[model samples]
Target: MASQPLDPGNSGRNDPALLRLPSTVRHRIYLFLGVARWDGCPLLFDLDGPVSPSDQVTFYGLLLSCRAVYTEVSALLFSSNRFVIHYRNKRSLQPLRNLTPPSLAALTSLKVVLNQASCHHRREAEASGACCTRVSGCFTRKPKGAGGHCLIRRPHKNLHDTPLQSSDPSARLMLEEWRATAVYLSSNTKLDALELSLVCDVDQKEVEAAEHVVAPLLLFPKLKDCHVRLCISPNSHLRQLARNASRQASSNPALEPASPTSGSSRLLITLPREVRIRILEYTDLVAPLKEVMWNRLGLGYHYFSSGCSAWEGVPCLPPYHHGCQYRDCHGQGIIKDGIVRSDQLRSIGCFCGVRHAAFSSTCKCWAPPTPLFLICWDLCEDARFVFFSANRFVVSDSLVSANPWLAYDVSFTPDPKWLLENRSNYSWMEWYRQAQPPRAYPAHRFAATKFLREVVPADYLGYLRFLELVFPPYNHECWPHDGHPALQDWIDTVDWVKDKINAPAITLRLVMAGSRMWHPACPDDRGGLTRVQGIAVLTGYNRILKPLAVLREHGLTRFYADFAWPWKWTNRVYERLRAADDPNTILSWLEGQETLLNDRAERLILGEDQHDRLRSNEAKPGPSPWKMHSGREY
Candidate 1:
């Protein structure tokens, strides 16, 4: 450690020892200096070209120290942080205009902030007492001699004097400003992320305006993440915009099939059509595409039957229930003057100690696929024919009229009527609100229904060859028994198919969701009994053949009652049965259950407990005979 220190030029050496280092070591130093220069420099650049002495010292001070440092650090600066482009006014763009192509090209991320109000408007607000309005906590008084506007938009008199303005600033004034900046920034093909923040009013139109400004950026080549944030101060509006923007941004697919001329085009297009078909055949969809529709939109399960624990809506008691004349109803139920409030009815627990899972007989009516199918046009069609045509789509009578989209053809285009109706409809608004973010499709201008209407092609719906209509339990007396509109949506769909294609081209499957074997032992008055009966009514082939016949009259070629239990529940039930029953008995029962719906369709609907009871000698002969009525005999 005590040896003499080596000297370069000072010791009469020809060249400096530092410069004599390896090229790799030199490059590393260049990188280090490039990053370190920031420590010496102020993070905030001074307005009007960084005139402050410290600002100059931070960037140029080190750069001027040597030519080599300048060359390396200059490029590093552009690639490191996002290039923030703030437009105070027309003349404020001078700094940007002077940026060289190389400097602009080095940038990676861009943030464009557009102030809703112009400098002139801001100045006028300052002059008028209205600008200082403290009534709603929106405006704050500027301290004397301090900066008058936001840190991002400081008071510069020359900024207001600039005469440049967009022709339609009132409507799309921000677009011109965006266009100018976009033209310059887009040249940098390396740009990955872009964020647009709009300082604007908190109103309905604000979202539309922000969307208009942000939509153009999504198509930017190499762009991965794009966000549009609102600038409303209270954050209510800002939060909503963020929720919607994130939802939309997350749904964007990373890769799409390329056109014929693109690089990926050869990879897919060169393959034979039969090979592509064969490839798709290997992929299987376990559940209907509707099961994962929420997943596609980046959300979780939202489907819940009415009056279920998961349903979201106001709850009220039956009209006949006198205000609980007695707090005597256990647990001091919502009672006023010893009478329970009808409104507190939903709080009542069932015999099972859980809330009613579905609408009860006497209670107030409770209101209740993988993305790979979309890979390419050809693949999608092939998969559709194989899956949709082969398997049955399950629908419910209760849901047909619940959603207007199901009842009628929906157009996704930004139609004026659809906007006005959806905006005003309370049900639509409530549903759309719950779907925000993680629960459903991130809230957007168009709800899931509207978005679907816009994106799904007309032809896509046409070729679906098989469909199943499943009705929910119909035994709830208190539930709103809205007359099944004779104007069934499926009938309309069938009619449309008849006009487009040959008769009997489509197969319609009608199904009840549960087995009827348990219904006889179940008490009719119990809510559980009603739930089983709902599916029991659809178990027999004769029960559904009438509706199927009507649908066939319209256009369907084949009609069948599919009494299959939901597979998800089936797997769970089977696991429990396997643990208790002999393996051979369970296997035989399973084989019989598998074909219960498909084997002649008129067999008794057997419940999981029926077989178990029969094997265990717990079975009792039922009054209701398992009589098979033959349709052929009729």
Candidate 2:
């Protein structure tokens, strides 16, 4: 084969030159490269780890090697819109002072991921080599992490050394340096999107530093996009999510520009169609999803907890009519609206308020509607190639070349087809069929249908396409999570779906403690499903007739009923419904017989018991006989 071309466009596989190509050709080249990624922009560099000053300079120099290559690569590298920076040593902070151009201009999106694990371990020991036995009093001690990461020790703010201690002179100096460089980058760089991951080993202050230092610059500029990922690790407190949120500058008139994050529709509903689809794909993002992962070994119906565990105990909420209002129980609140605490033995609800809603807990009562609820607040128009939570599907195309302007196709549809395609990647059988006996925790599963309906009207193609665009965190074009927990949930719900109902599964369910109460369940259980005494369906004007039906004729009951407690364990509330009503009084509700049936009942079954009364006196034949003797002799 010809030296496989790294340069995308042109004749077969040949080592394409990195320099001196006509601008049009290069642009077109990128456009036609590998399965149409961002219109063929292939400068994807996964530099999501610790960076030495050398690494930063190297990446910068490598991109700026020659103006021709530099022009194309510079934007892609910085346009990444996401970044992670792990500082192994305090000295590593020096790179922020040397950010190059184009990269700086296109650096609208940024995410700084840090390792906050074991970030507080400290010891009282002197640097042996630096210490003189003759003068023990003069030598101060140095701290070390098992992996060689050092912690600056101090006394004022903490008894045990922590990265938060302001007493350490060196730590304070490092903090100051971070602010200085961040200010400089802000003064010079123009970024649209930004994210920061706070791993263990780093203090909330590190994240606070980014908010204080970086936000002033990035948030002020007239930009279009802004993203921030506040990742809290195991050894770290989760308070930082709220802390960073507090740094939001919605009214800073000095820097407040009219754009997405600035109180205006940042990623507008009318973003390019591609972006719209992407939004749908990633609308359900849940980072730090390990706790929410119910099953990731590819074998069974996994239970997701922690970050991705939004539906835990969420009741069977319909897609339309009802708006979402997550309320915590007595002490533990519903973990919706971006709350992640599956391990704390709490409860959840997944109830909703609409007919034809993809999911429904009770269609008895009517509730106000809201936008399609997304755990992650920021969503974009690229639902096809990103997963807000996790990918249920992963498709790879080899046709993508590089072209910043070229357009590509990504799927972010709420259409069942897209959902099915998104689901094909999972092994639902892992624990699906073999799952232990159904156990009800004190959680409730409400419907999200009302929410979906509020956000998406019944405009068919328009709504479906809209879902594709508004949803973010999906990967239909390229790059998807290897083992997507959300995708796993999708498969579990789908596979468990009785093939006969082929009706789209409406409710999203999550696992939690047995004592906790979700919506229908109690709302005050911090100990999960175990705390709830019982669950009651909401009586809404909504009712389930048939998933497939005309708009008006659908059987809707508007079910809504609050519980009185002291009854019922954790079993599905839907099973309690015996029938729509008495089967004998069918004729009273039906008109002169050719009724447009839009429910789950068969006509023959309903009519069988009813007396057709005063029928034409034709002698009826006997019922068809059993064919026991028709086969061979016994």
C-alpha TM-scores of all predictions:
0.32, 0.30
For all candidates in order, the CA lDDT equals: 0.35, 0.27
Residue-level lDDT tens digits of model 2 in 533-578: 2211111101111221221122211111111121222233222323
Cα lDDT tens digits for candidate 1, 320-379: 123222111112223334343443321121100011111111122111123345456665
The candidate maximizing lDDT is 1
Residue 277 displacement (Å), model 1: 20
Output the lDDT of residue 193, model 2: 36
RMSD of 1: 21.9
Q: Candidate 1: worst 10 consecutive residues by lDDT?
A: 625-634
Off by over 4 Å in 1: 1-23, 26-67, 76-101, 105-482, 486-501, 507-546, 551-595, 598-634
Number of clashing residue pairs, candidate 1: 11
